[model samples]
Target: MSTRPPFTLYGSNASPYSCKMRALMRYRRLHFTWVPLNPMEMASHPNPNIRALKAKVIPVLEWPDGRVLNDSTVIIDALEAEFRDGRTVVPPAGPARFLAKLLEDFFDEWLMKAMFNRRWSSEVDRDWSGRWIISDQLMSAPELVTLPSPSQTSGLIKFFRDRQVGRLALVGCEDDKLWQHVMYEVVGALDMQLRSGDACRFLLGPHPTCADFALFGVLKQLSLDHTAGRFIQDHFDAAYGWVLAMDDLSGLETDVDWKSLHMDTPAVKKILKLISAMYMPYLVANGKATRGEWVEVEFHLDDGQTFRHKEKFGPYQKKCLDDLKRHYEQLTAS
Candidate 1:
């Protein structure tokens, strides 16, 4: 009965970015038709808009007007701009804004390694989590969701397991222990923030911001995937609560008074310190290597653990760093 044309979204359940965009759009009350397609199916989608995905990634949005937007971050940014009169996910202050953007990058880029590790590093995890994804998302028969030995299940398992396991090295944490190190920093630091004096429900405040959704994407997966889900439930109750809260968009309103929240606090400081010490150094090394020089970066976490990785310049991460600097500069200037 709605008048607006249905927005077309193509994605898969296993993609965190897809979940990110879906949750954001749902929270915004934007009516969109979701097309859940596996990687092969998505690429082969007859619609030229779906076929022309920029990053060849899922959660591509085709606007009613025939515009195609790829990349979850870009999609959210565009939606926020277009719907200025509606509820927004971006915080409205400079410091908080910058911090939110930084945290989004941290969650989306850096913490994703931990997520991947949790999903693919263990056979037990792959069997538990992969079965659910393959059954519910990839297969046409919902009744086969719990079946372990479907003829197609083995091929799908090998396909996903091999691809995801192969990606573990690219994430800079070849060992499970290193992945746990990153997870401890992220989950522990956020738990501290939640327990702070103000007791903000979301990362920035009561309202869900870009940071919250960015983290929510991975957290949602963690809460569903067997290994990471158990890890959060066992040790990071606060984080688990935040993840559930982000999934709810019951009362967010466009006309609600936006708070003048800032990100100057001990918890924020802790996260920034960790990012600067561990992640920024990695980005810097990667950036240098992007200029045709091979560089190795070492990360020293607060818990006295260290890991080193040799990486070439990454265009994606370089752009992320550049965007952060640019946004921070703009915030200072304004």
Candidate 2:
């Protein structure tokens, strides 16, 4: 029998999957030892972490009693099933369980594309692309992974953009005047439920359950609370506060070494930057700002008088918005 404690984690702290378990345990206050793992580390371990798991992935959980777990959902569920110390991620399993699963997968898969695409987007100079690229730009770059060929990444992006990803996102095709409103509404709904009052912190209940952690994974993609756009303030007072309670997971792009970006291409980078810039403004006009709180972004066409969304925004607004349509279409089609 291994001398390790009842909980031992063979994974890296930086991994999203790993973080899912870590965050769950953090709120639950479960004690576990994190045994670090990477491709290289796994290769050398004749113990064969891969052989035990059908595929290559991180965040394998091994209990001190000699039980091993693979897959984040499996691990969390197993823990919830076997060890319910009066704190559960959900009430007796039912529709809530299934909804939690769907939400977790949504954040993990669908949101990843937008998150990936946003990284390369910036008004970066040409010279900087070569120097900064993935390696230099990252706050803590992963070991340079020999990812699939650049051509392969392009193919995947094309496939993801065209066929695979958007089907689920468009399951809720919005016809709102501004897309940000629709996006934040969904976020706001979840936040409102979680933070029933200023004090009600957990999204589901007293402690974060699997459902809560799953939502956290997706929300992590959006920027931090300090973002210029008062996305939280405008949409729902609790949008930022609820997420903050879960520990901010929004700052993932800065630390990852993403593949498939053509940083050398200035136009592409500008497009990306444009996408990010639009988010703040989009949040303002479309999201939580009531008419009373709203400030007009443009002057009246007839008079110097300004108005909120109705007239202040002009051809320039239309121009920027038109540009956004193409990007959203790209995202939607993806």
Candidate 3:
């Protein structure tokens, strides 16, 4: 076995979580390689570039010992455990740590909903998805690649919007400028609260912690597109710039410039929940009860499985962690 620390990342250049992981690797100087994922493929298929790890999702981190960790948070946790060189990605313990997690969750899930809603809501997104999101090698004919229909687009937009009903959802009624205004305000609020009169320039101080990268990940996503992406780059320019600094420290590879990568592509339009929420409740219908308990939910993407989802969650979240754990235990039982 090679004694060198083995780190392999399964993610795409466009994935924000992947970017977050990349930023972490560079920040801490962790060693790792990256793998990109493309749809329309099986493990052995000559096309689709790469197959998704769990139902075609990205950001799967594989360790040198062959331990595969899914979800950005979980992977980050794994990094902290293995890279115990005294360099900490989180504060020394206190309210700062708690606040970091809360706010990170808020921005990661909520803000993503708003930003991508606008990106995918346009005609530009529809045309672009064809060019970038799907896999060309998977299909014999370029025209054969399928995309979400016009009506599907409208429904997806509405789906994200409606899900924000109860949450402190903050996109401004489908208008990009309004959305930017709100986004800028939110970032300002975080900057004020975290740094409030402290000598620390980062969210905690001195060292970049989880809070710093968490905010950066969400903000990075916001800045991905230049056309409708002016909110973070324009209003929160300083804070947005910090994301690059963190990315340098992080160990992931990102191709596009923060200010220049946004385009009208179907991939940009589609808002994906983190794999962690795969079992979480998702919003499906208005005025309906969602998969209230995490223990009962299991998200499926296939035709028969997808239909079983209750749209009542209104983009709600659920996770059957215990059940999954039990199942895992059973499978490994001797």
**lDDT by candidate, in order shown:** 0.75, 0.45, 0.48
Which candidate has the highest lDDT of all?
1
Give the per-residue Cα lDDT of candidate 1 at 43. Answer: 69
- lDDT of candidate 2 over 126-155, digit per residue (tens): 122222232221323245465445554454
- Each candidate's TM vs. the true structure? 0.89, 0.48, 0.57
lDDT of 1 at 215: 81
Output the lDDT of residue 104, model 1.
89
Q: By TM-score, how accurate is candidate 1? A: 0.89
Return the clash pairs for model 1, or none.
290-313
Q: Cα miss at 96, model 1 (Å)?
A: 2.7
Q: After superposition, how far is residue 127 of candidate 1 from its true place, in Å?
A: 2.5
* lDDT tens digits, residue span 1-334, model 1: 1257878887877888888888877777777888776666656677887777756777789999989888888988898878774468776656677888888898888777778878888889878766788776645433354555678577986787777777666555466887777777777877888877877666666567777778888888878888789888898898888778767574455443455455654556676787888788977777666564555777776668787765445688889888988888989998
Expressed as tens digits, the lDDT of each residue in 1-334 for candidate 3 is: 1247857776655566777777776666667776564323336434233333454555667677766666676677677776665455643334444434444454555455545554455556434433333322223333445755556555544444344332322221243443443354456554444344533455543455665676677666656654445655665555665666666753433331222222222211122222223322332121234444222234454333231222223332223233333434544552
RMSD to true structure for each model, in Å: 3.0, 17.1, 13.2
Give the higher-TM-score candidate: 1 or 2.
1
Q: Which stretches of candidate 2 lie over 4 Å from their true place?
A: 1-6, 12-14, 39-46, 112-114, 119-186, 191-200, 221-237, 248-334
Which ranges of candidate 3 are over 4 A from the true structure?
A: 1-3, 39-56, 125-182, 190-199, 250-289, 292-316, 319-334
Considering summed lDDT, which 10 consecutive residues are worst modelled in model 2? 252-261
